[model samples]
Target chain A: MRTLKFLLRKEFRQIFRDKSILAMIFIMPTVQLIIMPLAANYEVKNIQLAVVDRDHSSYSQQLIAKIGASGYFRIVADPRSFRDALRLVEGNRADLVMEIPAGFERNLVREGAQNLALSVDAINGTKAGLGAAYLTRIIGDFNTDVRLEWVEPGRFNPMATIEVTSLNWFNPRAEYRFFMVPAILVLLLTLVGGFLSALNIVREKEIGTIEQINVSPIRKWQFILGKMIPFWVLGLIVFTIGLTIARVVYGIIPAGSLLTLYVFAAVYLVALLGFGLLISTFSDTQIQAMFVAFFFIMIFILMSGLFTSIDSMPVWARTIAYLTPVTHFIEVMRMIVLKGSGLADVSRQLLYEGLFAVVLNGWAILNYRKTT
Target chain B: MPLWAKTGKTMGAVTVTNLTKTYEKGSVTALDDVSFRVEAGELFGLIGPDGAGKSTLFRILTTLLTADRGTAGVDGFDVVKDYRKIRNTVGYMPGRFSLYQDLTVEENLNFFATLFGTTIRENYHLVKDIYEQIEPFKDRRAGKLSGGMKQKLALCCALIHKPTVLFLDEPTTGVDVVSRREFWTMLNRLKEQGITILVSTPYMDEAVLCERIALIQTGRILSIDTPDAIVRGYPDRLFAARTDDLPRALADLRANPSVRSTYAFGEYLHLAFRQNDTENVSGLSRYLAEKGHSGIEIKPVTPTIEDRFIDLMTRETTPS
Candidate 1:
């Protein structure tokens, strides 16, 4: 324990003495939290839309007006004939073309039905798909209104109607920022724990100081813990700053106790830093350790249920997702922060992280040899 | 010294038996069937140039590396099995300056002391003489210190633990002359403290400072003895020859029928005469004059360790 104290003192001294690393630890995370949420939004809006209307009838005009009023599109072209409308679509002046047949009004009164054609440009598939869906919904609503106006007092109804209303819980409007902010917090902590400890011993090796330590009487565990504890404390400090940014910049205060969130964070850092040290033990240089840490951390973030729902993944992917600590931490963070969940709600995740802490750190300590 | 001479007493400070190591699947032999021992409290030097396997031998004895073939023990602890005890009982200063460069001198010293479960204050007497020289610059980063000060700081850290045996590999390789002299003086002081010192060096002059030395070359020990004894082992009588033109004189001496071998030492040429020829001064003077060399002078001279080393190396490479 005495040996550990001195080692920790040296580590903290070196870390703080390097001005660039200090800035990276404290300032960079705050900037990334504020900007990443604003830039990473996946919700698409303000689509550039064009429409071609062939018939000048009141119904056709009303349909065009309804499409314009839905707040998702802009009409850039209106042609007089079906051939002209098709030309508008071909020339990139229009995204959708609506053509009412020549006998449209006569057929609706006499035969009680009419045919309309819609042509859409599907080059940008996602934009075209969303635009087309919106236009279809508007036309369906217009048809329903017409049918309702046609019904007389003795006319038969279409059938019993069932309407579905969705209420998005937790994030009521489903703002992508709320989902993104918490996950970005996870990434920030990961960068702190992974890179710092990964480069610690290998840096000593490169600079030739590891030879002195290797010849000393220090226990392998003492050396490993000395490198880990300072970074562990630094990781928590960075995490606290990230949470402050989440609360102040994004107004995302946690619903559950901060105590529970920190408890999980502390254990998760041990597992992560342990993995980093394991890489350091196997690598002979700092560059090798950094690249290895990057490979694993990238996989951890991608497979963690942050950007995509784990349940939506295939069986093999889900199995791999369960192996990463980031996945479990993200699950716990959302539960406690968004849902106001209590201890019982996150106990399973706590157990998993605790086990990971033991296994990874244990393996690291065992693999670290005093002799080679 | 015979291995059995010290066996009945406390085990020698360090011992090795037929130790052999190779790199790249036995393609490069670093140490080939090597064995030696250093008596307790003796100042032993492993004298050789760079790549002479000095660093490799030191590493194996310090318990940082495992030998592939034989066994080595330090302070009565097996290097492989009892490494932890050996680590505590022995101090090693590697060939490279291995102290933390970014750390202050005081901090680096204190750190090594703390690692051995002691404080600098407790072991101040052991390193006081050396540490005091650089103590005024205690706050300076080790990387910024001069080459001499760096060597002193490294020695201070190595002695902080007061180990039974100290291993210093080429501690003066790049140090200045004044610092090298001061370093040897400090080693002598350490010897008075009853610490066994195993030091390696490439400088031939440094060999005489040690109580005994093993002259190493190409991973083999050519001779092990006192410096005077090794110098006395030079096989043939030698003469120092000089002329106004040295290169021509050297070539002329090698061509002479009376000369057996010749080598150029710093300002003069060292020559050996054939056993059958008499080496009168006029016979050599007349020969040089006939060869177009002027102001020629030749005289008998004593051999040094370097001359003996060159002799052994030439004889080893050349078949009889």
Candidate 2:
């Protein structure tokens, strides 16, 4: 306990000593949390499109009006030829191009067939796909309108339609920011938690202070535990502050118990701190520790499913994903904040995270040597 | 039993038998079957130069490393088996200034004290002398302190726990002359307080301050004795000689058959006669004067610790 007290004091002093580190811990998170969620929107809106309306009939004009009224696309230009529409897309002036055949309305009226072509930029594949889906939905609605006008008011429909009623569980609004904010919070915590502890030990090694500790009457466990506790507490404090910003600024209140989130976060902090300790053990310099921590953090954040869905990942990748502590915490944070999942819903994730904490910390302690 | 109680004997004495440590595992032997003992309260010095294995030996003795083949006891506790006990009994200051740079001097001292399951107030006297020197900068970050101040802080931290034995490995290497003198003075005061000190240095002049010293080189002990005794045991008659042209004079003496070994001392050439017979010096002086060496002066002088060290090393490798 005395060792823990000393370590905590030392860690706090170190954190407070470097002004840039203080800024990274307190100020950067707030800025990133607030701006990232608002900017990183997956739901695309106001897609700019050019239309080549070769069929100048009232029916074709009406179809264009229907596309414009859908509010998903802005008809930025009405080009006279298909080539002009293509140029609009190639020149980056438009995201999509819609081409109407010369006799589209006449073919629809006489032969019950018409064609509309949409060319979308597939470089941002997901955005392109969403744009195509929105355009298709508008066209389908127009077809329904034409069919309704031709048939009697109470006529029986002969086609079978499958309706997909998607009930977005946690975040009913499907706010991507709400999902990203919590994950970013976790990333910040891990980065600081692991990096700071790693720096603590590596700094000692660099400055030659480690030799003083090594020759002292202190036990190996005391020394390591003393070094770890302060950072762990600081990480928890940062975690709390992040959650507060989510609640107060973004109005994102977790559906699950905040107590449960804190508990899980506490365990996760241990795992990260242990990881840092492990890095420090192998590293002889602060630069080496920073680089090693950076490498692991990149892998952890990528595999954590912060920006992507883990469910969509392949089975082997999913298995590897489970090995990362961040993965479990990100899932738990999302479930609690978006889905309003109770402890019972996230108990399995908590268990895995806790186990990771124990195993990693145990391994760190085992590998840490009193003598070099 | 309390953890400290269980390892109480570690503070009693340290003993090593046939201790050997090889760096690069057979490529270089840092400590080759080196064995020595430091009785309680004795200030033992390991005198050697760079690559002489002083730091390596200090590390092994302090329980910061394991020996390849050897048994070492610190205060009646085995170095490996009773490492915890030994740890509690010894304070080590490595050659480098290694305290937490981000932390203030007081914080460094407090942290070290707390780690040892003690408090600074409980053992203030042990570190009080050195601490007083650095007290003015107690609030200053260790990184911002001068090299000498950093050295003092390191010593204070090492002494904060009041261990029975202190192992300082080249503690004064980079320190200024004044700081070096001040540090040695502190060590003397600590010694008077009955704390055994094991200090290593490459400086031959510092050997005089040690109770006894082991002159080591290339992982071998050339000689071990009191500084005076080591100097007294130097066998050959030694002389310091200089002329108008010192370099030419040195060359002339080296060329003379009567001169066995000659090396440049501070202001003169420290030369040894090939034949220790008192008759050889006159012939060598007459020969130098005849060889166009003017203003030549030669006087027999008592050998210093460094002089004896060179002579011992030379004799060790000579075919005879």
Residue-wise lDDT of candidate 2 within B59-155, one digit each (tens)?
Answer: 8878889989877777787888878887887898888777787788888888888878889999998888888888998999898999899889988
**Which stretches of candidate 2 lie above 4 Å from their native place?**
A45-111, A142-160, B1-14, B235-302, B311-320
Worst 10 residues of 2 chain A by lDDT: A1-10
Tens digits of per-residue lDDT for model 1, B55-163: 8999999888888897788887888889989889898898788898888999999999999998899989999999999999999999999999999999999999989
TM-score of predicted model 1? 0.84
Q: How far is A252's C-alpha from truth in model 2 (Å)? A: 1.6
User: After TM-score superposition, what is the CA distance of residue A278 in candidate 2 from its true location, in Å?
Assistant: 2.5
Tens-digit lDDT track for model 2 on A315-346? 99998888999999998888887777888988
TM-score of each model, paired residue for residue: 0.84, 0.86
lDDT at A58, model 1: 81
Model 2 chain B weakest 10-residue run by lDDT = B1-10
Q: What are the per-residue Cα lDDT tens digits for candidate 1 across A1-372?
A: 878988999999999888877998999899899999898766644555444444467877777788778887777666667678777768877666666666666676668788877777888677678777877788789888777767686776668888889998998989898888888888888888888888988899888788889989888878888899999999999999999999999899999999989998998999889888888888999899989998999899999987789999999999999999889999888888888888788999988888888888888888887676
